[model samples]
Target: MFDKVLIANRGEIALRILRACRELGIATVAVHSTADENAMHVRLADESVCIGPPPARDSYLNIPSLLAACEITGADAVHPGYGFLAENARFAEILGEHNITFIGPSPEHIRIMGDKIEAKKTAIRLGIPVVPGSPGAVRSGDEAARIAEEIGFPVLIKAAAGGGGRGMKVARTPADLAEALTTAQTEAKAAFGDDAVYLERYLAKPRHIEVQILGDGQGNAVHLGERDCSLQRRHQKLWEEALSPALNADQRHAIGTRVATAIADLGYSGAGTIEFLYENGEFFFIEMNTRLQVEHPVTESITGIDIVQEQIRIAAGAKLSFTQDDIVFSGHAIECRINAENPLTFTPSPGHIDSVHVPGGLGVRVDSGIYAGYTVPPYYDSLIAKLIVMGKSRNECLMRLRRALGEYVIEGVETTIPLFIDLLKDDDIIDGNYDIHWLENYLERRRQ
Candidate 1:
């Protein structure tokens, strides 16, 4: 293992990576923006360095300063947790040029998978089912309209390089396609610096299921099964659970094995997630995230595997200790993202956290960085903590989660606790009979 690794992000994930390094006896350097001078992750890390000011472009996303911090701290490796520079190919390439290890996949894998359209093509070539619509990126509204008519009424205009629901628009009729295409392209350019857009057959009510894979640099790889991230509002996942309530045993196994083999063929390494859209009974590949996902705790909760440790070991060229057979997924696990935002408006509510009360007991795990006095910064992501709960069955897990969420108390700044509490109250969510639009509709009705 490396003597020390620099974590290039902030919030709960930074603390998550820090705990992993500590368990592996690896020292960690936490990098922070000037706004986060006294953040929990910084104080918890073995060492810390401030890269820039409050703004992300000047600070957290500042590649030069991040590399400089690693160089000055003499960190042997750097772990970009999920967002920020995690999927940046140039970032990984720079680390390689500096002789410092990047605790993720190679730049080639990141580049291919990071591009939405390219990943769809790769999935299509691999015989993986993809939403059939666009052959590739389309140039004009006229092209988008022709494709939409062929694909049927409802179609989605998606950015060729989009994620986190940034550059997407859905059109139900031919007239809407032209306007939606223009809007998607504009948003794509603003968000990703690329105006390219593609088309896809939009499944009105589909479940977002993702397969988590762990692979050594060599050809050895294994899938940790699937997580049901169907609960989302505006394409952002709100809650995630393992062993999707939608899939049967056969569907799960088929998707798992296929994703494992395909990525292994690509020579991918470390921890990565292969996301698919499942509607009715059919599954279609969406894209692949070439880094650890924020919702990874649910997979780890049930598998009895420390994914961060596994990711680190793989980065160090250490063989994965568990095989496909050894990967026995037990029980059910659920994660509720607790963010510094208003439940009613779903807007960012960044301020000081007056007090924090966490629940405890067997099977109840809370991954958080904020405490009583931490000032929630408005410049970064709204996520403050992640509450993960596991049980022997889905029903039991839901019940435990309900209890745990009730016990979770964050005083002062507004949080999504009320929203999550309302979510738990819904019979659809509790019974897992909901889709991506379930939460949004539910919230809408409640507001009305």
Candidate 2:
């Protein structure tokens, strides 16, 4: 086991990683920017370091400062909670070169999975189903047109290195392909510094589904289950639930087993998520998140497995303590990402939290870093907390989620709590009959 672990991020996830490390008897080093000088995680960590000024580029994302902090604190491992450098292959390699363990997958796997083109090819090689379209990047407008024709109308042009719905466009008909292609390429270059784009058949109403897996780099892995993350706005997931209301027991087992087997075959280590788009009872591979996902708590709530702890143990050369049969899924879990933003206009609302109140009951959990006087800086993400609730059934979980959301209060700044509360009243959401486009359409209807 590592003597001390340095957390290289901020916000609620930093606190999440800190708690995991503390439970394992590992000392913690919290790295923060000037804006987070009084943050909760920094205050609770065994040691703290001010990396740089408030800007993420000069601070949380600064590799040299992180290395210096590790060296100064004598930390042996680093835990990248979710964003920032979590999926950066070079960051993982540099830490490895400096003889510090990165509590994640190998750099090789990260590199391969980071590229959409290579990841699709790898998924196909592993017998995973993928949306049929261009086998590689489409270099010309004419080539994109050709592929779009073959794939049928309404194809999606996606950036090879894109995420969060950026650098993506959809051509609903042959006449729209040229503009869509050019705009996607332009956005791709600007957002990711890569003009490489690919085409795929766009399903009209697909649901976003992802499988969570853990590996020990010793040819051993297990799948906890899947999450239905179809709710989103501008490609950002707001609501997530485990034991998706869309899949049956047989379907769940089939997909989970396949994902676990595939990860084990690739010798993947630590925590990873294989995301897919599902429609008409078919699953198509979209991409793979090479690091832990923002919605990991829902998986943990259902499986009763500490994913972060497993990540540390794997990095420390521990074999998986359990096998596929030993794993069991229970009940249903739901997580609402409560962001510090205007509920109506969806604008960032960062400021001092005057008074904060979190609800607690059986199977309800709140992961947050803000206190009464904590000033939420404008330089970071607006996600203030995660509210998770579990129940013996999906219906019970939904009711619990409603009660929990009603009780969660963060004053002196607006939040998205009202949006979630309104959502729970809708028949579509209650019946779990929503697709990926449901939330956008719902919001549009509200605007009307």
Candidate 3:
């Protein structure tokens, strides 16, 4: 086990990793920007270092600064808690070269899975179902149009290196294909510094389901069920639930097993998620997140597994603590990503938190880094906390989540609490009758 681990991120996830390290008897080093000087993680870590200014390019995203902090703290391993450089292949390689451990998958694995085109091809080679589209990246709008015609209308043009819905466009007909291709390529180039884009057949009203898996990098892996992350806005997941209300035991087991086996066979280590779009009782591979996901708590709640600890252990050459048979899925779990934003307008709300009240009760967990006096800097993501709740069934879980959201309070800033409160009462959300596009449509309706 590593004696000390450097957390290369901030906010709630940084604190989440710190708590995990403390439990495992590992000292933690927190690296923060100037804006996050009063951050909870910085206050709680055994030691803290100022990386750079508030700008992410000079701070959180600066590789040299992170390396310097690791060197100064004598950190034996680095744990990137979801974002920044979590899935950066070069970052992992640099750590390996420095003889420092990276608590994630191998650089080769990250590289392969990070590229959407390569990931889809790998999935297809492994016999995992994938959406029909171009065999590879289309070089021009003409090529995209040809592929769209062959695959039928309603194709999605997605960036090969994109995420968070930034570099994506949809074309429902041939006339729209050229514009979609141009827009996707331009956005992809701007967001990822790569102009490469690929086409995929878009499925209407598909439910987004992802399977979580852990591997030992030597062909041993196990699946811990799946999480339903269909509740999204602008491609960002707003809510997630485990033991998806959409899948039965047989369907879950089959998909989970296939994903686990394929990842293990590819020598994947630590934690990873295989995302799929499900519609009409069939699953189509969307992409693979080679690092821990933001919505991992829901999976942990149902599986009784400490995914962060498992990542560290795997990096330290430990085999999985349990086999697939030893794993058991229990009750349903739901997680609401509380963002500091206007509940109705969805604009970023960054200000001092005057007073706050976190809900507490059985099966309710709150993971946050904000305090009463802390100011939410506008330099990063708006997520401030994660409220996870578990219950014996989906209905019970929703009821518990609703109660917990009502009990929660944050002053001096707008939050999505109101949005969640309203959503909990909606018939579609309560009945779990939603898809990837459902939330966006609902929000549009509200605007109208």
| Per-model TM against the reference | 0.98, 0.99, 0.99
- Put down candidate 2 lDDT per residue, 1-448, tens digits, no spaces: 9999999999999999999999999999999999999999999999999999999999988999999999999999999989899999999999999999999999999999999999999999988889998999998989998889899989999999878888899999989999999999999999999999999999999999999999999999999999999999988999999989999999999988888999999999999999999999999999999888989999999988999999999999999988989878999999999998987678999998999999999999999999999999999889999999999999999999999988888999999999999999999999999999999999998989
Tens digit of per-residue lDDT, candidate 3, span 1-448: 9999999999999999999999999999999999999999999999999999999999998999999999999999999989899999999999999989999999998999999999999999888999999888898877887888889889999999979897899999888888888888999999999989999999988999999999998879999999999999988999999989999999998999898889888888999999999999999998999888888899899989999999999999998889999988999999999999998789999999999999999999999999899999999999999999999999999999999999999999999999999999899998889999999999999999
Candidate 3 stretches with Cα past 4 Å from truth are none
Superposition error at 9 for model 2 (Å): 0.5
Error of 2 at 53 (Å): 0.8
Q: How many angstroms is residue 218 displaced in model 2 relative to the true structure, after the best TM-score fit? A: 0.7
Pitting candidate 1 against candidate 2, the one with the higher TM-score is 2
Would you give me the overall lDDT of model 1? 0.90
Q: Indicate which candidate wins on lDDT.
A: 2
Badly placed stretches (over 4 Å) of model 1 are: none
